[model samples]
Target: MNEPFVRSGNRHRPLSEARARAARFAGALQDLGIGHGDRYAIVMRNEISYLEANLGAAAIGAVPVPVNWHWTGTDLEHLLTDSGSKVAVVHSDLIPAVEAHMPPGMRIVEAGVPAEIREVYGLGDVPLTGRHPVMDDLIDQTEPAVATDQAPPLAVIYTSGTTGLAKGILRDPVRPEAVPGMMRSLSDLFGLQPGYTTVLPAPLYHSAPNINMISAAALGMNIIIMPRFDAEEFLRLVDRYHVDSVQMVPTMFVRMLRLPKEVRDKYDVSSLKSVVHAAAPCPPDVKRAMIDWFGPIVKEYYGGSEGGAWVQCTTEEWLAHPGTVGKPAGGAAIRILGPDRQELPVGETGVIYGRPADYWPDFTYLNDDAKRREIDGGDGFITVGDVGRVDEDGYLYLSDRLNDMVISGGVNIYPAEIEACLLRLEGVKDAAVFGIPDPEMGESLAAHVELVPGAKVTADDVRGHVQRSLARYKVPKVVVFEERLPREDTGKLFKRRLKEKYRPAEGNA
Candidate 1:
């Protein structure tokens, strides 16, 4: 069997070497009394060590909880305690920030920042603090341990926590009988196959990329990992490596489209075969432009971390149906239900629920069973609070999030519709719409926009643009310009934060 080659920036390592390190780390973990069913935390930026830590945990039948390194202070503390992490593997530079927040008796293992990472981020020669046992030293001194034959536990991924505190989604071990089918479905959805060369520009901590890299490694596909995403550099790497496929989000497409024509045309990206995008809705115009640039190879899948991929659409299918997120894949069933738990008529928007017809590994909200029960829509179908409708042919169209809908004078208004219209206007880079309290109407629409570089627009201009396309009631009562909007690395907007900022204070209305 051929070994997979994994590269991040200028650093490269074969899968064999990574496996050796993982085995040694697994030995060290075992020495520390961590094994099957145990949980550990991994807090670091994208690097080869990230994979090593994850694989090492799997070797011992332990679970690795990938924490968003961007979190710090109380947020970081909450995760360590909530997950009951026995140990923490952190990047050297991040140790100081988390040191005071970690739970008592939890061991710490520090990974030195690689030269490639420092050069890319322009952090020159910062020495390791030697505050804890170094990961490399532990790996070098410890003998490799034999891996267990037992099925490894899955990572406990946390939700985005748009409504409140994040909840961990914990899955039971995969049944051996279901492994092959699961792998086949994943391989088809992600376009992973032997000898395929893939690039993962999204953060490894994200659910999609986390699953993507593991699947790619299992399939013996050469993988390129980006420490940070740059519009032009992505195209350059694809051309340089003769990349065959990639996974990206709609924000990436917008950034690539904004690049200068000459700069975009410079790279030879014809080698790409499949480019799958998700994590958020893609505007129709943006999807059309991406198809034009990358051919019909661009595809999309819709699912949450809890449910896995349910529906998928090819560029052709999307062209035919425009905004549909594709019909169900992997024999998954989708249903739109109204407030009374009754099935809504076709084309009538309501809460979207989905589940696989075959085997889907059962999951729970770690330590929060009540939260899991709340999402259950009866008969084993579950929803993540998304509001959407199914077409006559069964393709799904997301109207907006149930939590994000605005009630103005008792009329329902979906922010996604207004945001889509805002995206079409010239000079608009990004837009977010939400509800704010209004004395007369109970609630009113408010828009926050980010403009393209060197572009100028006014609140009236934005209002007029929407007025021309949508109903006057749908137009935002207030429009505010921003230098940039808060978004996750995966292109998901932190709209809850925006909503909080605009939400009326008690007694203000």
Candidate 2:
């Protein structure tokens, strides 16, 4: 029987057999035309096979490009075309939803379907072809137990370019030796003990969760997976499975905390050993509120989708620094540099940069190499265009993307700072800030907010909240309620989407 990684009504994959399955899947891919250095993209929800394919592809030197499952078919097509992917494997259930977006002449594979879609593998429920013509099946597979490959690179995850079209960040596979450092810091932050099972909460296609998943598998930790995020059900599932850890983004944390206190206490979550929060700047108030309820198990990580630029903080350090993203990890060098790429002194804001022991060889846009080399300083450093500052102790605090920073009447406003303050307001549940063209101020600030369920907070109330937390000039001129703010796969707020939807034309304004 297969170890069921997906836990809905059916959770069967035990931790023991997951590796065996990855080898089986790797062999399947090789037989399906995958080879060393080939590129294959996966666009699906959370499942064990996601990890299997990721590591499996790495083993064969085929690059795994995990596209955000929420993207429209057009969005996925961009990734498929941009990455020059040779083949694709998808969830049959989502096929109809994005089938029209698929490009012609692409080889396709499916795991779950109506049994009529020829050549389907009904993931978890059905088995693979027992014998295929692929070479020494076991040898062709990347050793499921070993993932670190400093050379050819692992996977290329695309950023949800809410500010622009998605840009891909290639990840170098981590080694068992590097696992100790990442796991030690992560375990210390999450309060984990030996033999804890962590649920892959965030989608594994993204960097943070992908790293956490592979490390968990190698460390012999049990793994559970969620197909997608559903707040109420997340709590129920946690209680039902007694999950110890999950890679989470702040977006989900706010929704879970907003659930009535009664609804929160409904589950027995004492088994939770740790929770990893990264891919966004979590608000200090949000962090504090969670500590009050869930204890000090939240671990904050500040790293780019690109290889460098990292800062991690634990719940305890977070309580002390409040907004700090902790000190560096992985023996990787971290720095704060000005626009000129010169190292900034403590207290000065600059672009955060990092050079991992092993970094992206050919960094930037896949088809657009010029755009890629633009961010690669060629000095062995990569900056994702985020502007930040380092304090005396080296804790990192982000302002916003260098280009996304808003200037109104000569004062610079960082959208993240405003968004953080917005999360604390009564009625506002989530917020995204962007700059819109303003005849008066060059570029004025605007916000799209998601309100707490049925809270009935109006635009004026939100205005008051922003006024209280920030400078008068920094307040948003527009505060529109959104059923949901557009977000990337990595849980980063898509300020680009908000700006496009609300910004007026140059003359229209």
**RMSD after CA superposition, every candidate:** 1.6, 5.5
Cand. 2 Cα-lDDT: 0.69
Residue 311 CA error for candidate 2 (Å)?
A: 1.4
Question: Pick by TM-score: which candidate is best?
Answer: 1
TM-score, candidate 1, is 0.97
Tell me how far the alpha carbon of residue 74 in candidate 2 is from the true structure, in angstroms, after superposition: 3.5
Kindly list the per-residue Cα lDDT of model 2 for residues 1-509, writing each as its tens digit.
32324332354566556666666666676767777767887766676556666667655667888877677756676777777777776665555544566666666565442221222223434333332222234434534434325344557778776666787765445554564565665455444445667776677777767767766666666676666666887888779878888778887877787789898989988887787787777777777887887788877777666763356778888888878888876555677887676788998988877765442233555667677677765566767788888888878888888878888878777888888788778777678887887889988878889987798888888888889878898788987889988765456776666667666668976
Regions of model 2 farther than 4 Å from truth: 1-9, 96-99, 113-152, 171-194, 357-365, 377-379, 488-490, 502-509
Mark the 10 consecutive residues where model 1 has the least summed lDDT: 354-363
Residue 238's C-alpha lDDT in candidate 2?
Answer: 79
Residue 351 miss distance in model 2 (angstroms): 1.9
lDDT of 1 by residue, 1-509 (tens): 65678898898899778878988999998887788989999998888988888889777899989998888776788888888889999988889877989989899899999887788778788688977999999999999877888987688888776666778889888888988998998888888899999998988888889989888887889999888888999999999999998999998998899899999999999999999999999988889998999899999999888888889999889989999999998889899999998999999999999986465687999999999999998887899889999999999999999999999999999999999999889999889999998889989999999998898889999999999999999999989899999888787778877888866678974
Alpha carbon deviation, residue 224, candidate 2 (Å): 0.8
lDDT accuracy of residue 86 in candidate 1: 92
TM-score of each: 0.97, 0.83
